[model samples]
Target: MTDTDSLVADLRFAEPDNPYLRDPGTSFHPVDELDPETAREQAAVLRDAVREHDARYYTDADPLVSDAVYDTLFERLQTLEETFDLDREGSPTRRVGGETLDELDTVAHVTRMLSIQQSVDADEVREFDDRVHREVGDVSYVCEPKFDGLSVEVVYVDGVYTRAATRGDGDEGEDVTEQVRTIRSIPERLAGDPPGFLAVRGEVYVPRPAFREHNRERVERGEEPFANPRNLAAGTLRQLDVSAVADRPLDCYFYDVLGWRATAPATAEPFSEVEDDDSRPDTQRAETAALDRFGLRTVDRSEHVGEIDGALDYRDRLLDDREELDYEIDGVVIKVDDRAAREELGATSRAIRWAFAYKFPARREVTRVTDVVVQVGRTGRLTPVALLDPVDVGGVTVARASLHNPEQIAELGVGVGDRVRVKRAGDVIPQVTEVVDDGDDGHFEFPDTCPVCDSPAERDGPVAFCTGGLSCDAQVARTIQHYASRGGLDIEGLGEERVEQLREAGLLDNLPDLYRLPERRGALAGLGGWGETSADNLIAEVRASREPPLPEFLAGLGIHEVGEATARNLAREFGDFETFRSATVDELVAVDDVGETVARTIREFLDNPDNAAVIDELLGFVDPESVETDDDGDALAGLTFVFTGSLSEPRRVASDLVERHGGSATGSVSGNTDYLVAGENPGQSKRDDADSEDVPVVDEDGFADVLAERGVDWPPAE
Candidate 1:
């Protein structure tokens, strides 16, 4: 941990003591009292800048700050190593843990998590349970609640449920066992005989009346709500559509069991050791009474506590009579009741010598910008958006946000009487990065076209598009609300709240009248959580979405610059719907990575004659079925490939497995990629874009040994 103490703990910092910090001490931290040469150069520049910004915020989903400024520079490098004694044993305070994800398959944890120390109030959880009863004196407690959600771990084996993970820097994670086998209180088998390889660890929420009925059905289907309820319970448990996270009602609670070898011949190391006759767990008295005798669900022991004035009188009775909590605690955890003075007061790589979290005070909002509209997405970009005035911050409400392009509306020059500065951004949605004020009557007027189809608004690089594809009715009602979305075409009772009650009851004006709504099936089974078998199961899910898939019927025909991976690479290389409606824009720029702005937006959406009479009356009610293969013969036909890592399918099924042989699927590795496949962990900037485009690599078992050396029969390996 040297090299001139990682260049003086990369010039350490940590300033905010408090001031409505909208990003103060901008992720503060650095007061741990230092001096062994500034705690060995601030633990070698905070363990090499928090492991390269935790690998650019969680394995490169790219973040650099905004987890409220990486938890205020991880609590000012935990208060400059707790008031400058700078405890550097290679500190991020001795790393919690990570590094497994080769598309997830590493498990190793025969017990060693130990990291939960916190403090925000109740006199720092009573000076951390009075320095753990002044280091092991008279103890016996356990309190738990701190669940804002998403810290799983699970395991089980003999008692059944098999795997769940994601406490990342606590040990390895991201192996969401096929999205925790679609959650339903996670049981896959254990009713009793379990304890064999049983790991346990808890949390995975959403509740708060299912996060305000899933953000009021994503703002009545104009789609995009979630910046709370722990990012829709961490994007519905990382969905890559495990049946869309088994129709979302996800919930789990557990608490803390960790590798239960049939309850240690029932404890003798005394609840695992701190001393006062240190050796107890033979009967379970708390880690929420040994994870509530193995069945889970434990954060409600009347907000558990043993006193810090009864956990600040149960956190001021949850901000006075439970701040309408149906879910979402954001504070009150308080632990350490002698498991031998919490193991003679151990831990500090990230948290816990005896527990403390009391925390709850920075969700922010100051709203004002009354008008800044622009919108238009579906790849016709144009964002800008704003419109605020509402407010509420953490308890949710936020009127409207997203100044994401127009270079964040001229780098946050957010006009219309400014005084803006919202948050939520990567917490879920709301954005407006900043525009506090510029006087000169806080400017505005940015338009340059398409106020719903006045056409021409093009930019790109800090985005702005709107060449008004197929006549924009607000980008065709946000692409038919992402084509009756729930991730495209889930159709059921059509949303955006019944497409604005069928556009103010003039009875919906598009997407072939949302499939002949049988004249609104008794007003969608009399709406309001709809009934009568949910309106005959929403006209049998809109007649099973007139049998979709031709890449979800060309992503529900919102076409113009088509996306959904370019409508599944134009439905796996034009094999139907009249060869992609008689291809042209130079025959989709002669296919391999079609471009010229997606072949002039697939030749202006097949030269719209009212979208080719709604694609020939929706191909006379659906059936463009052509599962590739005539990709005209073999050796990867007209070659051109790309893909990078973690692909056992998805990157639009590896561009329909390179247009199923007659290759053509590009998204980066350039110089006309004729093969760059590479798999598993790949990304040193996509192996330097396939070594400066000499592209060759391969793997998914070397594209099945180049499809059995071209005799092509590769489907048997799954």
Candidate 2:
């Protein structure tokens, strides 16, 4: 028996149900009852587990356990540590996050980046509002979505972008200016000019659509997808290869100008040393508005309310529409609109006193586990999935949830017909949190063999992996499907089922064979599902895909750790397939976003004798295009403008004018926005956001004047 089998053999259970999950009311009782030495030992085990989970969740973007399970381990460790006086430095409880990677230089923040106090209960929020009123009179509040992402401080001097750092340890952070600059939303130069020195703090996150595309590509490549967008964004930022940063679809939403100093040119010393007569925004709303006028993006939706009831109502509304947003937000942040009120309320040693993060309750539901089945992932990891009876979780119907692995299965002691609790983990993935009751049905027995390929699935740590690689029919079908999927080569009429049929017919063995489909056209036409027309169409698509631009070609290969963004960056860097194919590991790693792991994977795949021969053969049949510049090289190439409401022409026409002249047209008002072209009945919220940020708004005629100044014709020559 393997170590995994031995571990499973030792699972302990209570008389009726899984004892592994302790009672919520008294979860730490087992440790509390143990002797001091044993308690310390248990504490150690919990600590290591927490660290491992953190690494998986934060760094690897693949969490081995559910949030509920990790929470239990964390809470238990905290209890044991306090009981035995083991709460010291380096304890998991003391740190905000896992260790910062040494890929970037460390820099001390001008001012500490503090976290706000959080409350899940509405009553607590009310209490906080009451306390704020008692301390500093009745005040209006600015409430916005609390973005789920990495926080960074962006610095500018004399209106020029200079420094960007991560929120590491609050007081100090990693200097990721090189990586941060690659984010399109973050302006390289602040628009409205003229701040002697300023620092704006905001969240950097990957939007949902981009995150979904990234994971889809990962699954196609037979790799584990990231657990959440927040983790993926954070991991991407920390990558050593600056080129790697280019491929990731990242966005920044500025929330606060941490500090700013306005000074004359003659007396231009550091803001910290020479601050004397500069005036700053008097309110949080004003500051965020200033950021918007300065051409920086802010939260898509925010509210300014006069009463506590209004704030609470906004929070409720956000909870209802949370999943609808393009990015993740755990809750809404309510802050005193008046800067004076915030200062008067003061702060605790750790958190701001005037601001509160009204977090939503964890989205959970109760359901019955009908059965347990092993899912063979792209990487061949055998994950046990709880086949749940159809149940509503949050707003969606969940029929299945991940069990993580055998250890989690044993820990839950969940059997078929068992009642279990499930949570919409991060409001995205459904996960089994606990077994509520073990029914008369017996416990689930993990299969010893791979369900897909019938190979011996060997247990290693928490994952049971199938020994089969590309030989597995399921794996091959998935890979080929990935190669033809929308985000890949985008071959029409070739879905997973069709790919499976092709693979089974012995016409397709590897990705390279995809180009040779025309050779098997007669045979394909004679197959059960195919006719001459369909065969010809398939061959046409296969032929058309042979000349995919560099990025699409790289993405189609489904290389490990390489997604759409990474592929795009790589394509741009190498210019041609031959150059990328001949690049060394060091050369690859030196590219912006490519880290050591990704570099090694790329090198190994390309350097392999078999893989190289296949690549060489494919190159003969394909032509890879060079990366083209995103801008049209017009006068306004770097400027971003938003056209609102109705214009003389359609919104698309107006936007096209901007894009044609080398400017970007966006939907929302932000600090980094260069202009807002307003027409009849423009969105009040956009106008309000523009006004707050001091963003300049123009009528159609005024817009024409601005465009004319840029040497663009009012209407292109017809």
Candidate 3:
């Protein structure tokens, strides 16, 4: 058996196969290269960094790096620890999750998150069967398309659902009892007597049909899409308010039975999809059928086969069948069949040692680069994008994919009009995987400077950026646009259109200058497009925005390596704006998510006299507001959310909600978060991360519940 250290080393050698681990393959720092001590330190450092990024990226849809970069960092961390003696309990190399969150009200499981016996391929399955036959003397195994979704524990008290929780650490989880109640398939009121108190464990998922429609809307609207149905399903179940779950098209597949009533507990249920083609049910199989008849969405039991080879053949057939099936499946999940043998095989601290996920390769397709565009990000970085001729790759369109940077363009050797092989590298974001041709009139001429500001761009590593921060109008336009953004000041009258108008009219220069308009109300009150009333309203909004919470205030500043979500995390830990600014590198890094790089960037930004002056000016405008905002936010705030597809949020609510609450609303979920305020059908990305993190969902009513939870203990002081 591979000890934890040997396994980590194997992981180091293994190419991280997930799309989220996307990065340049050429620069991979093999884990074998690092010495033992260095591997350990690297593991700890990267573990903290990756966890923070995952929380921000998956839970909040707020990422500081592209998916490729995250993958790159994660894989390298794995490599270092695996090749050396550097494995930690909390090693980022494991790619599992953080320590069980404390915020979730504790729940003790009736049964432990049991281990799964695994088979990655047909050969492994045969080996598994060989061993099972030797031990249990002619036993079987169950195989099923492990629906790519979340593992759920369902508790029914006398045929009525008592509780539902995510498979957090396979122990206790955030009690999402309220949210699960809304899942129509879950049946809050079960059929027949559900064995007094039945605790059923199953995989809850969003159907592929729903997932496709959801992502279509997301794509059209410019919101992030869920990677797969499994992610969407997992995210959906964790909604704080069950009503939010009602709108979603969700379903479940019962696999293992974690617990049952005192009377039923003694009875064993056959493993789902057991490998017994010639099944005249042994008593356990009969019980499994009976349980399924009672309305737990159990897998199709008849598909099980006796021979491991036959099962692999069945597994392959199942993968093909997945194309026709309504639900999503990443791979075939094979588990031990005999009930007694499964118990003997046992489990592990993290995943089930018995079961394994044999993920399919990311779907790839070829497409031509019809055109190229340089998109200027909020931070003024010019990223090259490929405008494709619209081809489908990995069940999604491959048009207008990000090249990431100029170097990416050169590496692919692609230009304005060239043929390229585009792929959804990790079944996630679409990128030009490689260039198949140099089909062009000439070689690609990479931009030497910023396209918009014409600033001399410098490549510091793999990224290129416009260095003119405050001086360039393009930079200022983006900055002010970001400042007045919903995640920033949340000024009602200052959306991008209004920001453009102000910038064009020379009414606003930067974030801090907006405060000046209130003083110059007379001038603002008589602008060409605005009447006295409208101008005064704008002035008032700007004045009102001045009294921001520390989080919102920090986010509004538009610092590099910071977003509203990250800002809120920093503020909560630091307490106030001044203290955050004064913190040392060590102190900043001490925050759960903040790393040395983030800490240094923050310190460097604060040290600038110009930057400090902006903070000082913001301080003078008014007292700091709340640390965590609430339901009584801008009209769009505190809405219980599950974005099936997309919406207009564009990741701005973080800023907008902050101004309203005298605190901040962030992107991801944690015990401390107020709500999963969402729009449209948000991608499963946030929901999945939230489910794992154990945050509650809320609709308008739930929002009210949270507000009342916060300080609405008494009616308005009227």
Candidate 4:
């Protein structure tokens, strides 16, 4: 049998000690009946069993047990770990993911992650091949499907998973260690002998089937579906809540090694010192094989080709079969097979000389525009949508496409009865690319008034907005949903579906109408899918939010350019709602991080008579507390501090302390920064940035000394 066949055969059977291999009649002890010793032993056994199962399912594609059975075993293990307090550092239970991060930290890559040169023209690809042949005569090439997803650098130390980061700017990336740990396909520990240190570059993506199902569920729940799998994957990896990422169906395929170091048992010589060692992979094909042996999942469709023509044929076949695959691929990557050949070819500053990405033509279809409609978002921005004669583009039947705004509409000259060529931008959002044929109707004229509320529409640069504020029915539904979102008051049971139901029933018309729901509890309980218990719980949650934090209240208003961070800055600067509302444009611009545009937007929102009336009505039911201030002094004023690595306290706490002392703390180092407070094992990227920006680098103790010199106590009294 071939090596691959043998591996597959072995994966079909379970080890004798595996919990699932036990006799069907044999009953397991319940959690309540197990002693500490028994629970500990079972936990270890379960961890091993689950790891083996994950290998079979994710890597080998041969699962011995059904998903239901696997879930049962996983839940039992989690229960044991939590009940016995036997959780270890690398427990499989970590996959469930409950950890939350204040922000994504910045880290330096062990080596630069370069991009591949790409072109949609076949001639460009042939030129690349000619150059490669000139440098390294007659070298074979390895071809792989170029995944349309986010690129990440995953690192391992001593055969155990260490950390992961995004491929931001090639040299620096945002740390996503906890988020990446939740992907089951990525093994926490290497299967065989691994190098002392390894950093592999890979793409993380969501399967197309899962993406469709996720979008379907979102639409059913009255939530906006994500544009495409790539956007979803990127957003998921950057999420601060690990649990949210864990709930999503994310997978990864490792492609290239960015860094490697040999250790004892593998080799005594380090990777940098070993030039011709057989222990290290000599070719791209062998490197993929080595990654597979180390329990890393590599692309299955990769192949070795003798010449560029064969690579082109492979790309053609992949493009034809793209729709059949579970993941999205926009092009095919061709790389020099031999490592020596690649070194001889060398590389440019931005991309490698021995590799090229031949892209496919974008999927597009020509269809007629039947009508045009306007959509008003929660923030009052107006969007123009084109109703199209249904056409199939990239396997999706798109009946509507976004015209974006009036400027785009005028540029395309698109109107009713016009033939337009539609393309799914990024293989997700359908948009009109150009007018194929002008119709009898010359061009579509945008409305001068809001279609839903008849409010005067005004243009802000390229985009337009409704002056209706909360009066528009379309805007009110979305506004209420945003008001109760996690970034807002965080009231439970105020999801999109619930808000729609309340609106359709004429029970809610404005922001203050939500607080008035308590008086209409009897009517709410009578609605479909809601009983007395659910209604009362929702009412209680609403009542509980009558008095919210100033920042949250500000953010919940759906004000333009006012997100969580900006709201916090505004709250800290003004202290109270009355002061913040009355602040002038100049005063708002004086706040940290608030630019002229954002300051003007905030002022415009508060100065509007309609918005003021809503605020006055809301104030009757809601009382936002004044933000606490440091009355002692602003000794650290006019200074900006950036932090990296593990400090004496959490980074957010340190940042809050800085803000409390009238100083600004940012996430990245720049020329505006005054000091970089680097704790133990601080990121090398921040240090490099500090050097480049000529900013001072100080340890935690030095920071404390600086604070002490300002008459502020370090490690503030508990």
Candidate 5:
């Protein structure tokens, strides 16, 4: 078999007969260079590509190509169609999504949920602004985040949540009311005096923290983590079992009020087609405010810009802060603020003319892979990690990236000293997306023995595992570190350095040794850099960690398939350690998110006599506490805010204020930073970074204004 054929076979997927993908490098031939017949043939190829990608993205929730590649194909299709005058009926270009999944019940939308025209260039955004001005002079715009997630229409009657459906197509969608209801942020009942009948359109998303936790768990379990939170959220919502949906940490943020009806005023009109002033929202800002008033989550970052320049500025800021947000957003939705202006501007057959989706530039970066090294995880899984010539991906320096496995290495067709494309999207781990250089032919040798212990290594599916369990020093260190990690048991001050010290002293071997450290206080105190006071404090911290929340304890166990999110889900389902420990494969599989593969993994772990003994020993040293799932209302949760320069108060005071509001304040500016609070003489580098990343910089007063909105005091507590 050819290399591509071998890679395809290794992927365990049946390759589709795609015409456009015959040679991805030659997929697009300039329309101007091609004859009419050739152009038509190319158009046909592009049509197939678009249809295939749409199916992969919408129905399967697993897009085979990157958004950039898909967009390129779509643009080519549009060009060919225009050039050849080959516009076909029911073209994929005119549609919003793929065919509805058979597993989901279909529901026709009350009013069509049309898509927005997308543009990556700033010039296009400027043109859109100029066009709007030409059509309806000097109009204001409400710029909001164009969330990258599954779009859903939520319906309510008599202030009670009634139904919700996914945006499968423009006119119809898949009914996912039961699954959507499980999202805690989405209210079962509307707040205030809501309209008698209301329809709100929103994006169902996985928060960045939840997405990070989920992916981290997947990595620890020797599984390929999800590419992006948006895909995972969509896939979760489409699950056949509602219980599976509930297990996923999902949140919804309403963007548009599609329809509202009030009995007293007798006002009833769909927002999209409202004719009268009374029935229509005066401006986009008013509609968003109404959504917030009715107890729906609206984008707080949304701002009203007077003209095109302000809209562009907002767009830049959003790009800068893209990584800082908990949810994924592809672009800024720039809409004419005035309802009358929007009505006058009108819409196209597929999208609104009054608004445009100004998409952010693709985040992928191409860099040379200097070398490839094998890293052994706590679970004894060997993963090939790529060490790259430092590359800035989406405004972040990514030096090291995951190769996933030997199969992925083969599939990417890359080797050391080769130029490769790396992608950093949201909080997902930096990944080598593709091999760019053709000169390199040699691939990394998949080892037959463990790098650390020289133990026999065996491949299970795509993953290679070392036979040395606790005997492997690398595994032992990683396991100890995992136990002390933030999402695990969270033992204070027990970082890599301390874990290494303990390991070298022969005081640690397994999880139970952590709890027993206090008994050897004198031995710990005698160690270099350790004193009586420090030893006592360490012991106290270790003892305090005995009754960690059940989920954390489960995560600390380093189960093959159990990560923090899965552990939390399992903990929630089973209630306690006893139930989880005694769970059979059937019981485990019955739990939401715990499919047959995971169920078998868990059952096999528990069935092991050695693992059972370790668990029994650990149980005697520690008590598992019930998990407290509810986070106190954190107004600024998922926002990475930075306080720069000098503030009215001390920098610490301002930083503390941010923390109190549930937002993090970093000293440095990066792609992940959402807001930069700049005081007088703010660092030039920070300003430059903000400008480069498109992060918004606000004055000290502006920072205070945001705090006021969150109901937080300007001067935080000492």
Candidate 6:
């Protein structure tokens, strides 16, 4: 029998009969009426039963009991734990998740989590096979889907789940133990007798169906939907509230183990030395089998092959069935079966030599472009968008694709009525790639004037901008909406539709007009679909935002090239609105992440007479507070650090450490940069910049030495 078939057979035979399956309603008993011992015993039984049901549903995908019955059993278990205080750390009841974390802590991985070398060409795959055969000599290969989702490392101790972390930088990752505990597929305790210490790598993902449904619900509620399942899953896993993470339909599939120990260690050390056990799996296939035996969910579709041709066939078959799969996979991963062969091949700083990812071509569809229209954004930038005949690409019906700028349109020579090949870049944004047919049309001419407000449209390099700024109706509505968005002043009642409604009614025109709405409360309330209560609530929210943090105030302005991070940097650098508003380009360039382009953009926006008047008018009602700094030491006050590539800790943690020591941590390498901290697999562009700029490049250890020399601790105190 095949390995998957044998696994299914084993699961079927070992599956326990749930006592609550027949009459779930009859299983309930008041916790108060039961004795302590009775409650504890019943709770244990319920936990085992619930775990079995979960395993059947999640891992095997063959649930014997209905969801209602499972819920009833689970609810009863929770009640028993809450009432009689019979809760255990590994109980299934804890999956409901009420823990709140202030922030995710960093933890070291037992072993390095190296990336796989990937290629889109079949020749590259054959080349990799050649290299493997030259060293390992006719080794078997294991092929599995390369899941496109968040990678994490999960650790277990003595058959109980202990910690889980994001694959931040291979060496260390963000601790997400609380978030991972909520995934029902992951067992709180292993099903069979397992290793004392185990660290496995897996992908956390949202199933496509769940992702679509969630996005649909978000749209119905007038909230912006997530772009894709991978992004949604990553964002959901990072949520500080465990309850919120539990609410999302997140699942995981284990593929590889980083560390394993057969015997229990005396101490609670994460990675303790142990003699190699004969029972340990020696091949990739055997390792997966071991993972399955322990009740960890591994992909059942993976296959073992003796040659590269069989591996290629498996990849082709997976590509054919890609859309039907529950999770998103970008490619097929082929790994040398023998663990000893892998060890012999070894690895580079970034990737393993024994494994290679053969990626599929980007999903593309040919559709006729009906028209090209210019869209004015909140920053008055005009983006040419092509409206196309609706076509399905990667299961998503795409009707429009971005042309980006005039240069893109010219380069592609795309015109109305042209049949163009479109692909979803990063599987999220649709873009026109090539023209399949000219369709008997002349080259489309881009308009020289603003389409929205009939203002002068000026070209800056390849990009076109509407000089009307906030005066343009399209720009006005979007700008005001962004100003009140959650990332901005966070006015609760002012959503996209509401801002459009107010603009259509001529009750609102710009940012300052939103703050002036209380003066015209009667008119606002009398508007169609708006009542007195809604108007009052909106006015109150606007009033409440009269005094905002300096960062929020800067972000609310919707300046070109300025986002939340840059806004925060500006606020930290300038301290107050008056100082920031009057700053020249030279002064603005001193802020972290503010290059000449961004500095000039800031200066031009602040220097505009119309924009200055609007700001002055808004200042009559709004007060922006100075940003406070927590840096108490000037250890590295004059030095500026730019980080690139993977470090021992997350780049954010490293950046925070630098900022805490009164040093500037910028995103890019420039002439002003004092040091470029290059880690494993550093970006080539940053390294080139460091070389050209004559900036010193330091490794992680070198950075630590510099910190020591400055009298600052390497890893900051908790």
Error of 3 at 50 (Å): 45
TM-score of each: 0.33, 0.43, 0.41, 0.54, 0.43, 0.55
Global lDDT scores for all candidate models: 0.60, 0.73, 0.60, 0.82, 0.73, 0.82
Q: Report the poorest 10 consecutive residues by lDDT, candidate 2.
A: 10-19
lDDT of 3: 0.60
Residues 555-579 of candidate 6 have per-residue lDDT tens digits of 8888877876688778878889998
Of the two candidates 3 and 5, the one with more favorable lDDT, higher being better, is 5
Q: Can you write out model 1's per-residue Cα lDDT over 316-349, one digit (the tens) per residue? A: 6665433345566666666655454555577777
Model 5 global lDDT (CA atoms, 0 to 1): 0.73
Count residue pairs with overlapping backbones in model 1: 43
TM-score of 5: 0.43
lDDT of 4 by residue, 629-676 (tens): 544468788889998888888565566577787888886899999999
- Residue lDDT tens for model 5, 648-690: 7856556544554567666578999989989987889899999
Which lDDT tens digits does candidate 3 get at residues 1-718? 5443542332311223322222323265455565667666656656555654544442233454687787778777766665664634433333232223223355766667654544455566566567666766765556667666787787765565566777787666666665555454454444433565567777778765566666544432233455456666777666544545666767666766665543322222221211222222333355466565555556663355666676677777776665457666657766666666665656666665445555544444765564565655557676776655456686775555778877777767777557678767678877887777665555456677656556556566888765444444456667777777766777788777777677656678765678788777776666667888898888878878767767677777777777766776777677776677788999988864588887877776677555566567756765666553234544434433322223333343334343344454445556656456444566677777667767665443444455566554212332
Model 4 residue 538 CA deviation in Å = 15
Off by over 4 Å in 4: 1-16, 21-27, 264-278, 366-718
Report how far off residue 705 is in candidate 2 (Å): 99
Candidate 2 lDDT at 132 equals 94
Report the C-alpha lDDT of model 2 over 200-244, residue by residue, as the tens digit. Answer: 898999887687667545543344566567888999889876666
Predicted structure 6, TM vs. truth? 0.55
**Residue ranges of candidate 3 with Cα displaced over 4 Å:** 1-103, 117-119, 239-243, 262-284, 347-429, 432-539, 542-718
Question: Candidate 6: where is the Cα deviation over 4 Å?
Answer: 1-18, 21-27, 272-277, 365-718
Report residue 140 deviation for candidate 2 (angstroms).
0.9
Lowest summed lDDT across 10 adjacent residues in model 6 is found at: 12-21
